[model samples]
Target: MLIAQITDLHVSFDPAFLDGRVAPLEAVLRAVAVLAALDPRPDAVLLTGDLAENGSAEEYAFIRHALGELDLPVFAVPGNHDSSPAMRTGLGSFMRASEASHACYVVDDFPLSLVGLDTSVAGKAHGALDPARLEWLEKVLGQRAGRPVFMFMHHPPFDTGIRTMDACGLLEGRERLAELIAWHGGVVGVVCGHVHRSIHTSVAGVPTVVAPSCAHQIALELRANAPLQYRLEPPAIALHRCEQGQMMVSHVRYIPDFPGPWRF
Candidate 1:
């Protein structure tokens, strides 16, 4: 099975642009155009989070319009910037719900089982795995034992060492999240966003990925005390291909918003 991933669109409706600085909706449009042109296409599109800059109703409506042009299933979760009620309404009947009545959900029955976790702590940039979310995950995994699942979320459970971003990464009780991964041998990988930079690491023997945003990215800083460094990097997305024997391979791909040629 093949899956396409886009994250951190941070779109704003009405084309007003957020804070008179970033054009989040334009980025979203560029990513959509690229995805729609993929050759083999994909079974679904996974949006990790930060769908809007302020989680406004209009923003969600804009998201709905953009995604309606796709031919595959679209799934998403609430980021720090997403409002659950608005997301549900705008997304309509396609937003897959987990066993919980919320946005977190699991799509089983494929070689690529998708486990979407909600780590958005309302009104805060930081994230946490609350008790309710933990219990729901435990139950879902317990029942789906032996099924390889690819978990996705807005807040990465691990850190990238980019001080400011790490401060917004999954906070306390991450060890518990690790334990869940450790116990679930069927877990193939954990995919996340919100860092706006592409990176990867292993969590409990599973490959975890941090997908870059569809807009500007954070500068590649490896320091432990770095501040926010927004760079005009190529907007990118991730593609995960599930191979034989339950193995999953992923690649970080960037599609230029416009036609260009590079001579090497």
Candidate 2:
């Protein structure tokens, strides 16, 4: 099974977002076009978080329309910049109802089980997994025991060393989350998208990935007191391929019209 991951779109109705420094709408459209052109297209698309610049109705509507072009199953979770209520109402078709109040849910229709975690904190840039949400995850994993699961969320459970982003990273319940992944033992991988850059690590012996943004990315500043900054770098997405008895492999596909395919 092939699953495509697109994160931190930051799509806005305004073309001149971020003082016209980044064109998020155009960037996302290009990403979508790239996905559409894939030879063996991904079976599903995962929208990790920050689908909109602001959790506004108009922003959601615009993104919804843009993503509609894919015509493939899309799963999404809320990011810090997103409004849960707005997302549920606007992107209901892309999400399934969750037993918990948060936007957490699971998809079992494909070869790889998918668990989406809602790490967004209302009106805050940081993310957390409260008791209720964690309990929901535990229950889901228990019910799907022995299944190869791929968990996706907005905030990464580990620190990325990017000081500014780390300060606003998953601030709570990460320890417990790591424990859950270890205990489950069937979690194949954990994928996230808040950092806006492709990063990889391991959590509870499972490969964890942070996919790059489809729009601007956070500046790669690891300095001790560096201020938060974004760069209009090349946008990209992640593709995960899964097969029986093999570890899932992920690839980063940049969404730009760079010259390519020259024979070596």
Model 1: pairs clashing at backbone N, Cα or C within 3 Å: 98-105
Candidate 1 worst ten-residue window by lDDT: 255-264
What is each predicted model's overall lDDT from 0 to 1? 0.80, 0.88
Q: How do all models score by TM-score?
A: 0.91, 0.95
Tell me the spans in candidate 2 whose CA falls farther than 4 Å from its real position: 258-264
For candidate 2, list the clashing residue pairs, or say none.
none
- Residue 173 lDDT (model 1): 54
The prediction achieving the highest lDDT against the true structure is 2
Clashes of each: 1, 0
Model 2: lDDT of residue 259: 26
Expressed as tens digits, the lDDT of each residue in 1-264 for candidate 1 is: 788899998886545553344567777888888889987998888899889777877888888889879867888977888887778777775467554445678887576678888888878898888878888888888888887788889998887888898888889557888898788778877889998888888888788888998876787888777668776577798998876576568888895853222111
Q: In candidate 2, what are the lDDT values of residues 1-264, reduced to their tens digit?
A: 898999999988775677666778778888999999997989999999999888999888877888889999999999999988998888877888896469999999897789999999898999999999999989998898888889999999999999989989999999999999888888888899999999999999888999999887888888899888877667899998888776668899998862222211
Number of the top candidate by TM-score?
2
